[model samples]
Target: MNDKSKSVKFFEQLSWGIWIWSFIALLCVSIYLSVWAPLGNIAALLVTGISFAGFYSLSIKMRTTTKIEGQMLISNKAKIDLKFIKSATALDAEGFKRLAGVDADPAAFLAINFWSKTGVKVELKDKKDPTPYWLISSKDPKRLVKALVKAQK
Candidate 1:
């Protein structure tokens, strides 16, 4: 039987607050420019609208739920059930070599952001959910993969 405990990781809500604040700042800048700068009110409005849309997108992206259990990495939005992952296979030798160069372990798993370029991404077989699935980072990829493999059985 799989012995690993189930854990939930929710993205902090404070991140949403930050995005809201950024949007507000952008709006303020746009208003100021509209009143005092060469750009007309129409241009300012466009800039403000774009900034708001960008922040809105970021807010949506920041919200997510992660479930890690014996041999499975699940995301509620994506409805992904990644089964039978081997711990060693979680991070390949090349990834490990890269981490080693930075005094880091490839096994460590971290959440992915817009900036991250490396990590595993998987999609659920089901077609209901729209969010993409990921196994972005793992501190012990091999162990996690092994746990997943065992859980799948």
Candidate 2:
């Protein structure tokens, strides 16, 4: 069973003015290449098309939902759903321990490039199909951890 205490959502969208300006710039560049340099036009068009497609794919993938529940962490996206089970804490534990038999700092190891600046750490469990455990950085880190602890109980 899962008990969702909090939910976070993130979206990627440019402002109207920025989007318009970007479109205009693209149009102008396309015109210049098509008239002034026909050979380069094909390469430019292909590159621009690929770039737009890549951005669109990234935006779609970035749409995600993160839910922290009792002993479970859930990350949902358009393609797949990931689940992570919490590890048991010791009688006298300081912080989250590294995965079984693995000697790496969970914080440094799970730090991803795209979301690293957000101060979030995501570590995978040691199981065959291990789930990812995340330590998200928040202005109120204590409060967030407390909330997760309360939800576990």
Measured by lDDT, the strongest candidate is 1
TM-score of each: 0.37, 0.37
Query: Where is the poorest 10-residue window by lDDT in model 2?
Result: 88-97
How much is the lDDT of residue 38 in candidate 2?
Answer: 54
Off by over 4 Å in 1: 1-15, 19-36, 68-103, 112-153
Candidate 1 lDDT? 0.48
For each candidate, the alpha-carbon lDDT, in order, equals 0.48, 0.41
Q: Give per-residue CA lDDT, model 2, range 43-142, as digits (tens).
A: 7677666666665676555444444533444434212122332432221111333322154443332312232122233444556643344443332334
Model 1 poorest 10 in a row by lDDT = 7-16
lDDT score of model 2?
0.41
TM-score, structure 2 vs. true: 0.37
